[model samples]
Target chain A: MSEELKALDVAVEVDARGTACPGPLLEAKRAIADCPDGGVMCILSSDEGTIIDVQRWSKKMKHEYLGDYEDDGYWRVFMKKTA
Target chain B: MSEEKPNLEEMIKQLTARVDELEENAPGDNLSLGVISGDLDYTIATFIIALGAAAYDMQVDLFFTFWAIASLRDPKKKVKKDFLGKMFGAMLPASSKKLPLSKMQMMGMGPPMIRSVMKMHKAKSLEELMKEAAEFGVRIHVCTMSMDVMGIKKEELIDYPHMDFVGVGSFVDMFQNSKQCWFM
Candidate 1:
């Protein structure tokens, strides 16, 4: 299952590290949609509110909130449209 | 001095139709777009919508004249929502934070409360969105006369790479040669 998933996905890199909450999330949505469906969106934000905003917004928007990762100074959240 | 200027009539027409799309319904379908004149919440929404349109590949040229230029401040800094009721805590689902619509206008109390509620719910800030638009080639033009009239200096705005300082004549000429135009 993991192998099939990996084979049918695309990833977007959104560098919104210095921005405030909504900015990063919105950009992330944009970058994610620019790719094909079944693709993964990685939103990188440094704002204190990024995690919460993405978590809530993605779920509401119907995108699957995969998880969050920390690298260097930013937080990246991944989402994939499941429906 | 004016003699040294090249023929604008010919040059301006060439910039028509193809350089920038002018219609919102049809992305990348307008070379002449609307010029929004003020700085207010609705104005900000207009900017956001324009950016959204451009993100869809539309060519948009926004002229921020008068108070509209004031919105370029640090978006995360302050302000609350308008008549819209506010939301609280990040974990709270946005649906749970729906604005309570009022029927009999609650006097002037609505504005402040809206702001408080928005601050509480945490509406998305506009800074990063503006920056993203600039990166995607959405041209933001600031009016020089309005800046001077409002006592604002050029050095104050954020570092948006595509921002330009142009006058009304430029916008007029550009729009005159365009197929579609609007004023928000």
Candidate 2:
């Protein structure tokens, strides 16, 4: 999963490292909007809830969920805006 | 002759009709909130729930009555009022920004401390959540009777685009149509 994620060029980066549940997810939603269609967005979050929340939100919003990776006590989630 | 039993086709038709009838009577995908408390924590909790529900595509109706109406006031907008009204308004916080904690306020230190903690955690403030809720199309309804009794003018409240000054009956109608309702 990391290999596949590392290959995709990230069009936008949202640093939500200190944000808690729903905050990271909401920030990702707003950040994804700024990216062009089919563009990739990377979000960094310290909150554990963000991993599942972003996956669920991506599925519900019909976006492409590219998985996540943990580094330096935070998770970095990648998503592609399909719509 | 033996009495005839209903055939498979006839049973299927009856079942389909019953299903249609039930679907017609089902409540709408809406969450109705009765906001009765003006306490800071309670108000924050209310907006959090509303925002969460709205995020999931649920229509949210917030009915503000009595003290809860004070949470909608605009801190910068001052309106002339009678002696009792002025006293009541003065005692209450100007807006969601000035609301004090329900317990251990410590002479107004508690609110600022809590706000700093929220900031440290990167949680959205109550004011920001309220704005997001409005942007998400949550309908904010102010109680007409409460405004009359408290002598609060409509102009004193924040100018929310979708806000409606309504009566108890209107709120009841919305509640009846909601899939879930809460009184906070």
Candidate 3:
């Protein structure tokens, strides 16, 4: 799943590293608007909660949660805007 | 041909189904918040939950009452007042920036320490969160009774989009319409 996500073409990248709880989520929510419909977006966050927050937020917003991977003490969470 | 009378049983069943569908779809799209604390941490938590719920596209109504109204006071705006009003104004925090933490105050050191850490961690400050909340269309309702008791005038409040001075009954109306009601 991680490799598949890594290989997926992304339309937007939001870097929210070093932010506290909910900060990265807010940033991802704000940045998702820039991603074209059905396009994949990535959020890089150092906050551990961002992984689950992005997933839950995606579920609530009806977006598709692709997957997430850890790199250099940070997480890269991916989602696709689905109308 | 004579028109047949509508079947009472069938009509009742259809009406029941329609009401069920409407009830299912109507109640869960809004959240009502009762903010009664003036502490910085509580205020921040209130906004965090509010903004998060708003992100889900839920309608959010934050009713600020009692001490919470103190945080909404605008420092730059001054109003002439009676003795009691001036005393209340002088004693209360000037704005969101001046609020103290509820715990671990450590002789007035906690607020600044937490604010600095929040900045270092790239978290939104209270002012910034309030701004975002405004942008997200969150409704801010101030309790008129609390305002009157606190001697806070409408002119002294911050200028925010979608803000209103309302009574507790109005807040109860919002609460009744919301899927969840939070008291802070």
Question: What TM-score would chain A of each candidate receive against the reference chain A?
Answer: 0.77, 0.92, 0.96
Best by lDDT: 3
For model 3 the local lDDT of residue B68 reads 97
Docking class of 1: incorrect
Off by over 4 Å in 2: A1-83, B1-21
Per-residue lDDT of model 2, residues B88-147, tens digit only: 888877898888888878999998888889989998898898888889998998876577
Poorly placed runs, candidate 1 (over 4 Å): A1-83, B1-28, B31-37, B73-123
True contacts kept of 1: 0.00
Enumerate the candidates' DockQ scores in order.
0.01, 0.01, 0.01
Q: What CAPRI-style quality would you assign to candidate 2? A: incorrect
Global local distance difference test of model 3:
0.86
RMSD of candidate 3 to the true fold?
Answer: 17.7
Count of backbone clashes, every candidate in sequence: 12, 0, 0
